[model samples]
Target: MAEWVERVDEQDEVLAVVDRAEAIRRRWLHRVATIVCRDRAGRILVHRRPDNMSRFAGQFNWMLGGATEAGESYEEAAARELSEELGVRGQPRFVLKFRCAGVVSPYWMGLHEVVVEDQVRPDPSEVAWHAWLTERELADLVRHEAFIPDAREAYDRYWATAANSKRP
Candidate 1:
């Protein structure tokens, strides 16, 4: 079954509903949710997109999430994605939302983070490989272009914020 997505304007106003494929093909601004899950050990969980994925195939990305469907809010989408893709449930802290000109399609992405002790069981179809990485290790992936491009943008902001918080 094909999935539907919410289309939005530059101001993030509801524009219309569209099939996910059509939206991607046209590079429309659609609602997407992304997560950065951290384990108690201070390591971040990262996963590789399946090789058969239409966009960013085989690229490593942070956490788990999917697009917000018609009439669903970003939080709802994030929570649902966590349950579906990671098999864990908890309130993820809202980080930020912004527009990204992604390689496949431009998107209005809502990013969140959660600290969890639950063992992550990433869905095989969505994630080909999963591992825990230190902040330095993750930063290396960004530098080497091993990470997904759009997600790299978000990670930059996330790391910047984290760095600031550590300032005395």
Candidate 2:
């Protein structure tokens, strides 16, 4: 069965629904939601994508999320992805959403944050491994250019937003 995803425009206005593969193959602008889980230490949780996957295979992902289903909002999608992928559930704090061309295709990506205290049992098919890292530690790894491009953008944008908010 072909997975379907919602296609949106630059302004996030819904245009139509399309097959996920065709959307990627044609570089259609689509909606994606990412969930960034953090522990008490402020360490971000990262997951390694299985090598056999289609997009960013074998690379570590900064967020846990996927495309928005036909009628779902970004927030709903993020929460659902979190539960489905990591075996956890919570209301995530939405950080940002931006339209960008990335490793998969051009997408309007929504970045979300979830501070969790429960066990995370990642879906073995989607995540091969997982780890928690501080900002500096993640930065070191990121310098090696191993992240999915759009995720890197979201991370940078999240930090930039955080930094700006801290201004006194």
Candidate 3:
């Protein structure tokens, strides 16, 4: 049997627990969080989801992230996902929040980015392939439709903010 996480409604008043399969099948508007980890060399890590994934299978996305557990803060969930999926231990800084709307699953996604210097050992079950690319290269991939649309926006926003803050 698949596990189900308890989630609160958008209004933050009603609580409900739905199985993962039901959540996807019912097109529930749930909350999912992701983190973008970059290296000091200005390279960002990207991962390809397993082809068997139910949604967005074989698509390239950020290195590590997933849904936020009930009662879990966004930062806490991001940090936990980074360590759980990528095997990298570090604190992630919150960047922005975005939404991904699909025919079945509409999600409000929390975006976080972090800088790390350690090696990443991604979970084979969650990530099929991984790589690091410069911002320009990432943008090119986005242009070529090599990345998830939501991820592309997250990367662009993050890079834009970082660039603007570096100016004198």
TM-scores for every candidate against the unseen true structure: 0.92, 0.94, 0.83
**Highest lDDT model number:** 2
By summed lDDT, the worst window of 10 consecutive residues in model 1 runs over 159-168
Give the C-alpha lDDT of model 2: 0.86
lDDT of 3 at 119: 88
Deviation in Å, model 3, residue 36 alpha carbon: 0.4
Instruction: Give all candidates' CA lDDT scores.
Output: 0.85, 0.86, 0.75
Candidate 3 residue 41 C-alpha distance from true site, Å: 1.3
Model 2 CA lDDT for position 9: 81
88-151: candidate 1 lDDT, tens digit per residue: 8978888788898887889998998888789878889898998899988888887667788788
Clashing pairs in 1: none
lDDT of 3 by residue, 1-168 (tens): 764554545643326766756776777756677888889997888789899987678888864787777667778989999999989998898876655664457666778888979988988888999899887777777755757777766667766776888821
lDDT of 1 at 138: 85
Per-residue C-alpha lDDT of model 2 across residues 1-168, encoded as one tens digit per residue: 888888788788988999988999999988888898999888989888999987788987778999888889889999999999999989998888888778768889888898988999999999999999988888877656667777778878888988988921
Badly placed stretches (over 4 Å) of model 1 are 164-168
